[model samples]
Target: MPRALLLTLAALLSACSPRVLSAEGWSFRIGDAAGEVRLVSRQEFGVCSPKLVGCTVPLGHGCLVMLDRDYFLNGTPRQRTLLLAHEVGHCLDASVLEYGHGGIGAQGAVYGEYYRPAVEGFAESYARAYVAVCGDNLAPLGYGSGPACALPDPRTVRVSLP
Candidate 1:
């Protein structure tokens, strides 16, 4: 094919590219905990940087957000969903700090381990609690900072879905 034809083809493909849904500082509530989801990536994971698999960028009051969307991982749909929830957890934690609200991470040691930082613990615990509410006790263990596992009972924890 000629270069001109190739360029035209590229332009057409780019124009037809599907748009990915994204939100900035989207507010949400899970049970008694309420906060904004800083960044929620649905089909992609960790698209922010080339080196990162995933991350949460914190802006004042939490607006600007970027995650590691660099490369494709051999992640299954279920695992990607978990990663998405984890990133949402980061957003929730960021809002809690800015707005002075009682988000899920406020409960120290309840959702996270003492050895790690609160931010990571927040994401990890939020993921666990998310799965807890869904009753996914059979989820694969040894994920996140605290070796995250689903909580014992769904009734013990409250989760809000929208």
Candidate 2:
């Protein structure tokens, strides 16, 4: 999408806040029809937005997701889906809303890795578990290679963001 249209869409997005689900792992889904997400696809430096590929805003019970279309456009199909999944991870992951200071998921850095296990780390782990089901191959956003690519027994897997 063009930058103009992307910005227009951003402006046209609902003013209401996002309604995210507060479930563990990939147990819950964030419905599109419910307007639980407000996507803003625009020009960005990689998934390098302030929040990287995207950001999730917590709304108490749950939270809303705001996306950077750049990731969707620039990333591979696998990367795109993983990006959305990553955002979903942010919405449902408690560590992000509370500890990461309102879901600053991998904002320009890796999270959930052994070195930096934190809020964003949990969210990336959520996305990582998702790709693992597909097979052994790793697919990180844009870079096309993920970390660990497996979810732990208690769903506390840690792998750095792409």
Candidate 3:
């Protein structure tokens, strides 16, 4: 192949390749749908938005979870996995509501107080469940002192879809 063609092919192949993360007998891949979610989140939040330091944005079929380079470099493997799993939970519709938003007064109160917490709780529960199931494998990864290992009761998680 011509040099230019070879370079172009390489770029194309790279673009088509899925983003993958693997550890402790668990592996995850972000496909095209998830890539779109990440693009949207990057556009909306920009790089390292303080507000989105540790947040998840759910798209229709997927979600974008932010984990700054600092966290990836400094956090324990367990923390990294827990964060990813929590966001994955959101992508998988673990929350009662499809999205979180509300106005003031009674409805707003529900949206602000109840809705957001329910979703967060659900996501945390999902992460915790994963940790519980894989505790033996994940323990060495430094998940010893986090919410991932000590998850809340799923029954307590309220869900009011809108």
Candidate 4:
């Protein structure tokens, strides 16, 4: 194949491939349901703070999950998977609100707190559960120590994916 054709093919293949977020002993595949997962710098992870590790932005149909490349580069596979799972949980939970569960910005309603510890707790629990189900040896990183899989009652609406 010509050089240009080869480059085009590579780009196309990359576009079609599922984004893989991997660490030392574990890896998670970000599927089409999540839209796109971008690995960015800490400064890019959030607004005015290069120290943030990850974030999730909800899109109409899917969502965007951004990981801090620097954090992951220095962290263990367990840490990476834990953070990725937490962000994914945020996206998944937000989907419920986007689908007209309660109303616009229903996630805030469910959070129902000054700092939204409940929301963070749920994400942490989700990460713990996911790691357990996958049978990975790594211990829960952040909120895993709090609850096993505790999600707020108000935010526990059923979501059907197609």
Which candidate number would show the highest lDDT if scored against the true structure? 4
Candidate number with the higher lDDT (3 or 4): 4
Q: Cα miss at 126, model 1 (Å)?
A: 0.3
Give per-model TM-scores. 0.40, 0.47, 0.43, 0.51
Candidate 3 lDDT, 61-84, residue by residue in tens: 444444444554466767766665
Each candidate: how many clashes? 8, 5, 1, 2
lDDT (Cα atoms) of all candidates against the true structure: 0.41, 0.45, 0.40, 0.47
Write model 1 residue lDDT over 37-64, tens digit each, in one string.
Answer: 2323433323344344555444333322
The regions of model 2 sitting more than 4 angstroms off are 1-35, 42-51, 95-117, 134-162
Question: Which sequence of candidate numbers ranks them by lDDT, best first?
Answer: 4, 2, 1, 3
Candidates 1 and 4, the one with greater lDDT: 4
Q: What's the lDDT for candidate 4?
A: 0.47
Error of 4 at 80 (Å): 0.9
lDDT of 2 by residue, 1-162 (tens): 233443343343333221212111112233311114444543322222555657665443354455665565577766766666666666555433344423333442454243144565656665666666534333322124555443322134445355
lDDT tens digits, residues 54-74, model 4?
Answer: 766665434556677778667
Q: Which portions of model 1 show Cα errors greater than 4 Å? A: 1-50, 60-74, 97-115, 134-162
